[model samples]
Target chain A: MPDRANDPTDALRRVDLVLRVHDHQIVGPEGELLGNVDDVELAEVDGRWLVTGLMVGPAALSQRLPGKLGTWTHAVWSRLHPDREPTPVVVPMEHVTDIGSAVALDEWAARRLARTLGLELWLREFVVSRIPGAKGGSSDERPGDLVESASSEATEAAEGGSESEAALRPRPDGRPVSGLLGRTGLSPDGERLGRLRDLWALGGPRDGHPEPLRVTHLEFTSHRLGAELGYSADDRQGPALVRAFFRWLHRNDRVVPISALTGIDDTGRTVTVETTHMRHPFDQ
Target chain B: MKKFFAIALGILTAIGGFVDIGDLVTNGLVGARFGLSLGWVVVLGVVGICVFAEMSGRVAAVSGRGTFDLIRERLGPRVGLTNLVASMAVTLLTFTAEIGGIALALQLATNVNPYLWIPVVGAAVWIVLWRVKFSVVENVFGLAGLALIVFAVALWQLGPDWSDLWRQASRPLVPHDESHTTYFYYAVALFGAAMTPYEVFFFSSGGVEEHWTAKDLGVMRANVFVGFPLGGILSFAIAGSAAVVFQSQGIQVDTLGQIGLPVGMAMGQLGLALVLLGFFAATFGAACETGLSVGYSISQYLGWQWGKYVEPLRAARFHTVLLLSTIVGVGTLLTTVDPIMLTEYSVVFSAVALPLTYFPILVVANDRTYMGRHANGRLANTLGTFYLVVVGVAAVAAIPLMIITRAGQ
Candidate 1:
C-alpha cells in the first residue's frame, strides 16, 4: 500500500463510522440498491482500529438490535439460512467506491455482490419471474442480467485479495463495530470515564484507491441516546427545539485519539485511555 | 407552452388526488354533525401537509432518498425499527380502509353487497399496481377524481346561506348540543384525514420514481401551494354540501351513499353519477397510493430496491410487499367490519402516528449534508417547527380523545 501516513490531508478527513456509515443503503453503480451496510467489520492492526469490510444480510443486521429482539432475529435468521451454520456476508472495504446518502459499490463489485442476496434471488426465481408482467417494466437490470456479466477475473481478485490479506495478518477474527459500541471506557488510573459511543475514522486515498478508513478517535458519552439521534455532530440541524434539547443532553460527550489508548480488553468490555488526551468532540 | 401544461397537469392531479377515503368520510361525518364549525382544522391540516410534503419532495429531489431511508439513517436501527413498525401499521390500516372504500363506492353504483365487491376490488387494485405504469395510475385516477368538483357545484346549487356557514366557520366553537371532547375529537380526525402520513411517503417515493431534480422544484412547489389548498377546498365543498342537505335533516353520514345524497338532492341524477365516479376514483387512487406506501416504507427502511420505475422482478421484495399488503387489506375488509368505521379509526390512528413520520422529514430537510445549498430556509424551518408541535399535540391527544368521545359517538 502507498504510504498514507505521509499524506498530511489524510488526517483531516474524518467520518463518524456508526453515524455516517453503518445502516446506510448500499447502491449499485447503476443506482439499483443491493442492500444496507447492516454492520461493519473492524480489525485491530498495529494498535490502530481499521474498518475492513461492510456486512450485509439479516444475520449481520440482527446483531445491531437490542435485548431479546436481537437474539430472536438472529435465531430466525439462522433457522432460515440454507447452511447448517452460516456466517454473515461481508463486502470488503476495497469494493466500496463512495459513501454519501447511500453506500455505493464499484460497478464490478456491485454486479458480483448483487448475486449474493439470497432472498432477492429466491423471490425473483420462484415468485416474481413467473408473474406475467414481471419482466415488462423499463428497468434494464433484470434478474440474471448482472450475474451473467460478472467476470471471473474480478471475482478471483476480490476473493484472493481478502484471503491473502487475512493470511498475512494471522490475527483474531475481525470484530464488528456493533460489538465494540457500549463497552465501558476507563482512564489509565482505572477511573470510569463513559461508555464508548462511536468511532471516528479518517478516510483518504492510498495506492490509487480509497484507503480502508482508519479509526482515529473514540467518542465516549454517559449515554448513547443523543449520539444515536445524531445530535453529537456539529451541524446545526433543525426544528430548533429538538436541536437545543439534544445538544443539551449530549453536553458531556468527549473524544480521544486512538493513540491515547493504553489497553483494550475485549472480554472485560473496557478500554483504558489517558484522560489528558480527551477533548470535547465538537472542539475540532 | 409544454412546460405550462405540465405544471397545470401536476397541479390538477395534486388537487384531485388529495381527497381520499379518509377525507371523504371525515369531512362528511364532521360536516353533518359539527357543521362548518371545524373548518379551520381543515385549513390548518392543509397548510401543515403543504409545508411537510414540499420538504419531503425537495429532499427526495436533492438527495434521491425516500422519507423512510432518512428515518432509518437519522433514528438508527432500534428506534428506526419502531418508527417503521408504527408508520407501516398506520399506512396498512389506511390501505385496508381505502380498499373498503372502493367496495363501498362500487356498492353504491351497482347495488351489490360491498362484501361481494371487496374481493373484486382487491384483485383490480392488485392488477393495476402490478401492470400499470406509475404515472398512468397517478394521472388517470387523479384527473378522474376531479369529478368530485360536483360537491362544489352541488353546494352552490343548494343555495345555502353562505353568510351563515361563514359565521360558524369564522366563530369556531362547540355547537350547543355537541360536547367539547366530541368537537375536538372530530377536529383531530379531520386534521389526520387532511395530512395522512402515507401522502408524504407516496409523494417522496413518487419523486424518486419520476427522477425529479432541482429543476422540478418549481413545479412541485406549484403543486403544493396551488393544488393541495384547492383540494382542501374540495374537502370543504364536501362538508358544505353535507351541511346544507344532511345537517338540516339530522342525518349523520354513516354510508358512502349517504355522503353522495347531498349531490343527488342538489343536482339530480347527473350530479349523483359524477359524485359516485369521483368516489370511485378517489378511493381507488388512494388505495393504490397507500398500498404502495406500505411497500415503500418497509423496502426503503430495509434498503431494498423499491419503485414502480423498475421491473417487478428486479425489486422482488417490494412487489412481494405490495402483493401481501393487498391480500391483508382485503382480508381485513372481509371481516365484515364497517368501512366507514374503519375510515374513521384509520384517520384517528393516523393522527396518533403523525409526529413519528413528520419529525424525521423536518430533521433531514434541515441537514446540509444531504441537501447542500437546498437545505431548508428560514420560512420553511419556522413552519416546519410550528407544525411539529402541532403534530405532536395531535398525536398525544388523539387516542385519549377517541376513548373519551367513544370515537365521536
Candidate 2:
C-alpha cells in the first residue's frame, strides 16, 4: 500500500490511496464555496490514468449519488432551474493553480476553464449532431437538386448548422455543455476511427493560460474496455490479468494531437482531423 | 385526408400498444380482490407515464438520445451503472414474464404446454428484432394489441350496474375484507403495471429509431396524452370486468387464463379468443420492448452502438446482450417458475425501481440544454413534480407492503 499522506506533492497528498476524490469540497483561493467534486476527470497518457480535472456544480453533485436518487436530484434540480445550463462546471488541473486544504483555484481562471470542458465538447460533437432534422443532407434527407438551396444548405450542413452553436452554449437552461469523455472519433475522411476514450493534458497552465492543457493529445480506442472506467489508460493499476486484458483490448489505441483536428462536422458528432498531423504520443 | 389517416393511425396504435402482461395480470388481480377500489392508482400511474413519456419522447426527438443515454450522461458512472443494473434487472425479469405470457396465451389457444412455447417465442422475438423494421414491429403488434379493447366490450356485454362500478372507482379506499397494507400493496403493483419503466424506454428509443423531429412532436404527444389515458381505460375495463364477474363470487385471479375468464364468461369462446389474441400481441410487443430495453440501458451506459436502426452486425455486442437475455428468459421459464407469479413480482419490483428510470427522464425533459424551446412547460412541471412525489412515495412503500402482505397474499 502506498502512503499518500506522507507524499511530498500536494496534489498527490490530497488524493487518498485509492485516488478517489469524489465528494471532496472545492473552494476558491479565498475559500469561497465553488462546489464539491462530483466526479474526477481523467486522461490517458503514456499508459497512465492521470487526473485531468474535477467536475463540479449541481449537475456534478447529482451524479455523485449512487443510483436513482442521483437521477431524481438532477431531475428536480433541472425542473427547478431549467434556465440554468445543467452542465457541471469543470475545473481542469491546469486552472487548479493550487492544491491545498480546499483544492484551491483562482476563481476567474476556474470559470474560464469551466467553459471549455470535454463534456461540452461532447454535447456539441455527439448529442447535438444526432438531433433529428438538425442539419440538412442528413442521413434521411438526400440532397435532391434545388441547386440554389443546395449550396447554402451544404454550407449550413457542413457547419452542422446553427444547432451546434446552440448546443455549445446552453439555450434555456444555464448549463453549458461540457465533458467529452465518451464521444466517438471520426477521421477527416469520415472513416470510423474509434471512440474518444480519454484526453491527455499537461499539468498546470503555461504562459499564464491553461490553453496548453486544452487536450494536447486525444486517446482513441476501437475497443470499449477503457471507455467508461478508464481501465485501459492505467495499465499498471489493476490486477495483472485484468490490466493485461485491457492492454490487449486497447492495443490499437491511437493518440492524435489537437493540431490534427481540422473541422468538427456540423452535427458536432464527429471530429475530423488531418491524418498527416497524427503523431503517435505513445511511441515517444 | 392523408394526414388525418396518419394521425388516426398513430392514436389507434398508441391505445392498442399500451397494455402489456403487467397491466393485464395486475388489473385482473386487483379487480377480483379489491373490486375497483384501486382503480385510482391506474389513473395516477397513467398520468405519470404520459407526463414522463411525452418528456422522454420530446427529448429523444429533439436531442436524438434515449433516456438511458441521458441518464448515464447526467448521473455519471456509479449512479448511472446502478440505475442501469436495477432497471435492467426488472426489465429482464419483465421480458421473461412477457415471453412466458406469450407461451401461456398460445397454450390458451392450443392447450399445449407453455414451457414448450418458450423457446419458440424467444426465437420469434429474436427474429423480429433481427429482421423487422422499427415501425413495422411497433405498428403490427401495437395494432394487434388493440384487440384488448374486447375487455371493455365484454364488460359492456356483462350489463353490470354502471352506478356501482362508478361509485367503487370514485371512492378510493381499502376494501372491508382487505387490510390497508394489502390494498396499498396492490395499488403499488397496479401503479407499477401501468407505468412500467420499459414503456418509456421503448417509447423514447423508438422515437430516436423512427427519427422523430420537432415536427413530429405533435404526433408523439398525441400518442402519449390521448392514447395513454384511453389505454388506461382499457386497464380499468380489465379490472371492471373482473370486478363484475369474479368479485361477487370471490374468485381470485392467479393465472393468465383467470385474467381472461371474465371475458370468457361474458362473450364466450369468441370474446376469449379475441382477448387471447390481444394477450399474445400485448405480451409479445412488450417482450420485444423489455428485451431491447435491457440492451438499450446496458449499451447506452457503455456508449456502445445500439438499436435495430443499425445493422445487427454493426452492433455485435448489443445483439449479443439481447441474445443472452433471451436465453436467460427461456432458461428461467424452463425451471417451471410460474410466469403469472413472475408478473406479480415484476410489478412490485417495478414499483421499487420506478424512481430510477423516472427521475432521469424528468431531469432531461426539463434540461433546456437539450430540449431548447421544447422543455417542459409550467403545466408539465407541475404535473411532473406531483407525479414525482407520488412515485417516490410508492417506491418507498412498495417493499414493506410487499413483505407485510407477503407479496400480496
Candidate 3:
C-alpha cells in the first residue's frame, strides 16, 4: 500500500462502530426513513476488514438484540418472514450517503436495489404501500416513478447479463469487515498502543480497479471516542482556533500507513502495525 | 407582474409568520413590567436575524444545502455535534412551548382546559406534518397569522400617550423597582424571542424544501429586509399594548389571556377574536416550524435526508423523530406547566444557544468553496462580524443573568 502521510480524503468512518449506530434511524434521499442499520456486511481483503453492505431488516435487528430477547425476536421475525433468510438484509455500501445521526441512502437507486431484496417487499406490504395516499396520490412527481423505471432497467440488464464477464474479472479476495472496529491495537512487542477509532482510505478508483476504494491508513486515538476529520492525517485548513484546539485535543492520535501494518488478527479486530513507520497525527 | 406578486406574497407571509409564542409571551411580559425599556433588544435581534437569515438563505439558494447540512463539513464533527445538541435542545424546548401555546390558543376558543387541548393539538400538528404539503402548511398558517395585525390596530386605538411611550422606549434603563440584572434578563429574553435559532434553521431549510435557487435570493432578501423589520414593528405593537394597559395597572402579564386583554379593551369582542385567531395561527405555525427544524438540524447533522416534501413513510426516521417530539411536547405540556412561563424560559435559553447556530452560518457564508461568488460580501461580513460579537456577549451573559434574576422573576 502507498504511504501518503498527508491524505485528506479519508473521512469515512469504520463500520464496526455499528454498535453505536444500531438503533439509529435510516433515511432516504427524500428524507424518509428507509430503516435502521441492523448490521453491516464486511468484506476482508489481505487480512483487512472493509464494509461491503448493511443488513437492515428484522433479521438484522435480532443480531443486535441480546440473549433470549434476540432469540425470541428472531423466532417471531422468522415466523412472520418464513421465507426470509436468517441472515441480515443486505444494502450495498454504495447506496449509503453518510453515517451521521442516520444512515442516509440514495432513495431512487436504493429503492430499486431494495425492491430486489426482501426488505422493501416486507416494508411495502406491511407498512407504506398500505397507507392512505401511499402509492401515488401524495405527489405529482412521485419517487415511486423513479423506482419503477429503475426496476425495469434492472430487468433489462438482468436479461442481458453475462456471468462469463464476471468470471473473467479478477475479484478482490476480501473478507467481511463487520464488527472489526473499536478494537485495541498492540505493537509487535505486546505493548498497548490505542483503540482503533477509524480506518482512512484512498477512496475512489485506484490503478483503474473497479473496486469502491482502498484502505490506506488506520487512525488510532488514545482518547475514548474517534477523532473528527480534523484529526485526519492531512486536514489542516479550517478556522485557526478550531484547528488549534482539535490539534491539541488529538495530539496523541497516530496515523499508521498501510505499509506499516504487520498483520491483523483472524477476527479482524486487533491490529498489529510496525511502530517504526508510524507518524504523529500532525506530522506533515 | 407575476414575479412581483410572488415577492409581495413572500414578504406578507414572512411578516405574518414572524411572531411566535416566544414573541407573544416575552414582549407582553416585558411590556407589562419593563414598559418598552427592553424594546431596543427586539430591534437588535431583528437586525441580527435578518443578517444571518439572509446569509443562510443565500447559502441554501446557492449551495442547495441547508446551513446544518454544511455545518459538519465546516465546523468538524465535535463542534458541529455541540452546535447540534445546543440548538436542538433549544429548538425542542421551543417546540414544546409552541405545542403548549397552541393548546392555550385552543383553550381560549373552547374554554376547555389547555391540558385537554394538548393531545388534540399534538395530533393536529402530527397530521399536518404527516400529510400536508410544505407550501400549503406554510402559506395557510403564514397568511392566517396576519390576523395578529389586530394587535397593532389595537395599539393605535388604545391611543396611549405617544410622547410617554416614546419616552419609555428612548430611555433604555431598568425601571426604578427592577434591578439591572432583571432588566438585562428580560432584554436577553426579548432578543432571544425575536431571533430564535429555529427561525433561521426553518428559513434556510424552508428554502431548501422549496428548492430555492440563486434567482430566489432577491425574493428571500425582500422577505428578510422588508417583512422581518415590519414584523419587528408588530412585536413592538404587542409590547406597546402591554405597556399601556398592563403596565399602568401594575398587573404583570402572565397568561395568553392577559397578553390579549389590551386588544379586547381596545377593539371590543370582534378585535379580540381576531387576535386570538392570530395567536392560534402564529403559535401553531411556529409549532410546525420548530418541529420541522428539530428534525432538519438532526438529519442535516448526521447527513440523513430530511424534509416534508417526501412522504412520511419515505422519511420515516424524520417522521419518527417528529412523532417522538410531538409525544414529548405533549408529555411536557401535560405536566400543566404554564405555557407562558415555558415560553419565557425557552427564549432566554435560546439566547444562550444563539452562538451555536450563528457561528457555522457565518463560517459557511464566508466559505468561497461552497458559496462561490455568492459568498458573504464586505457589507455582509462587516454586519456578520458585528453580530457575532454581540451574539457572543449575549450568549455568555444569558445564563448568568438568568440565574441572577431567577428567570426574570
Residue-level lDDT tens digits of model 1 in A1-284: 11234322235666778877888889987999888888888998776778888888787889989889999989988897655655677777877777666787777667656656667766766777777766733456664553333323234434545442232121256888888788899997788878998899888333336676899899999877747556666446666787888878778888999888888798999988988878887786
TM-scores of chain B, in order: 0.99, 0.98, 0.98
lDDT of 3 at A95: 57
Question: By lDDT, is 1 or 3 better?
Answer: 1
Each prediction's TM-score against the native? 0.93, 0.63, 0.73
lDDT of 2 by residue, A183-273 (tens): 5677766776676655554444323344323345667778754343324333333233334565677777777876676655545666666
Please write out the lDDT profile of model 2 over residues B61-173, one tens digit for every residue.
87667788767654556667678889988999999999999999999999999988889998999877766778888889989999999999999999999999989989877
Q: Which candidate do you rate higher for lDDT, 1 or 2?
A: 1
Query: For this target, which candidate reaches the highest DockQ against the unseen true structure?
Result: 1
Fnat, model 2, is 0.02
Predicted structure with the largest TM-score when compared to the true one: 1
Best by lDDT: 1
Residue B306 of model 3: what lDDT? 68
- Which tens-of-lDDT digit does each residue in B1-409 have in candidate 1? 9999999999999999999999999999899988899999999999999999999999998878999998888788899999999889999999999999999999989999999999999999999999899999999999999999999999999999999999989998788888999999999999999999999999999999999987799999999999999999999999988888888778788988888998999999999899999999999999999999999999988889899998787788899999999999999989999989999999999999999899889888876656766778889989998999999999999999999999999
Model 2's CAPRI class is: incorrect
